[model samples]
Target: MSKIADNIESTPHSDLAKGDEHSVKTGRILVAIATYNEIENLPILVERLVDTLPEADLLVIDDGSPDGTGQWCEEHAKMNVRMHCLHRKGKPGLGSAIIAAMQYAIDNNYDVMVNLDADLSHPPEKIPELLEAWRLADSDSTVAIGSRYIHGGGISGWPLKRHFMSRAINMYTRWLLWLPMADCSGSFRAYPVNLLRKIDFDSFLSYGYSFFEEVLYHLKEQGASFVEVPFQFVERQYGSSKINMRKAIVAVWTIFRLGLKAWNPF
Candidate 1:
């Protein structure tokens, strides 16, 4: 057993089901989904994920969704032993939600925390592919990203303007931050808990979409390796997008500021 698991074995949550018992390949896994009024998509996403990776524990980090998303999570967690939820006040932003998830993984002694959008844009079935990639990663400090820009990967639904904006931000991240990953803005990623604990999440500057890129920059600073796993991305079929023009502007500005901290600020 891993050191994390050994620690868990001595805690109150020791009785919690161990993913390693079911799948020796993947250690204790925590699948984290950040939700903000995601009731329309969350239920189906949770079911699909539970079915896809029954071994891994599921955590829904909700930002006080008035649509009863947190209520649903509480109800479901009571019935599903492997399911859990974190309730936050108001809509703080995706960055804070993910940071909470990371802290939870570290506190609970999880080996890996696989984070994805709750909108169902990221396929639940591809989670295993991420875990496999992490397993095969050359370094222990590794993060596996489900990349739509990689070979054999493409988006199912997205406007031309959306595509342009995404590509521009990605190019900016690569050029400024020196990150080589093709999909820096994507949310589907698997982070090892050991590596996540090394960084201080409280000092994050971006609390919105830009957190995606900012995190990669910090991880690279901590000597974390990254691997891109190709996966098809589907646009959300339900509910309106939470992103706004303000958030996009903030992302650009935040990346520029972070870029200045880098040696090659171009």
Candidate 2:
């Protein structure tokens, strides 16, 4: 088991300090979002997130969006003291952007890191809830997943086919990989920064949208404890989804390969 996971499992839940409560010490949290061509949604997302979590810092990782998302973030950074931006030269995948942001959070010594979508698909209002889940569990919990498959959660804008596909994917993943949480594909999540640092970022191989799934699998193998919080997913209002048949095929292939590897150790 990973050192962090071992420590969490060993510690009693009742004794751990709850950071989410108003009485507990408010730790420095970095809310990181990976973006590409989200210029239209950037401002709205920033505004809502900032309003929701004024104490937490916001970091936007833009991968050379032709729509000038980086420039927009730069302008916003000047106005909002807690907002920062990282600009890349070309379109790197979502997974790469998140890795870069996570590395930055670790390097800066932030207490926690929250990853979400800039398209507003993941509700910005639930930031506190996810953070609370982590803090309440103390440092024992490695990840808090904002899940839509849970009882109080569901998707808003997805078509019937997409919804069916998502449900099937999650079900297959659960049966195949034995993932602990309900929504393994959900993007909204919170991580204890110190625990995340324990993951060897250099060894992480996934660079596509499937990175989230890969990270969860790795953490599970390391015995990381994951808590699921119900979240309502709202479809993006502004930009087109980057998902295509190619990405879907890649994700399925990756999941199968990883599942096999997990089941059979050479």
| Alpha carbon lDDT of each predicted model | 0.85, 0.78
Kindly list the per-residue Cα lDDT of model 1 for residues 88-187, writing each as its tens digit: 7667778877887787788878889999998989999999999999999889899999999989989989999999999998998999999979999999
Candidate number with greatest lDDT = 1
TM-score of candidate 1 to 2 decimals? 0.91
Runs of candidate 1 with Cα error greater than 4 angstroms are 1-24, 264-266
For candidate 1, the 10 contiguous residues with the lowest summed lDDT are: 2-11
> CA lDDT of 57 in candidate 1?
88
List pairs with backbone clashes in candidate 1. none
Model 1, backbone clash pairs (residues 3+ apart or across chains), number: 0
For model 2, residues 1-266, the per-residue Cα lDDT tens digits are: 22211111111122112222222356778899988899999899888997899777788887778898888887777776677777765565777777777776776667888999989898889989998898887446469999998899999988999999998888877776778889988789998777777777655556676778878887777768898999899999899999898998888777887788778968
Best by TM-score: 1
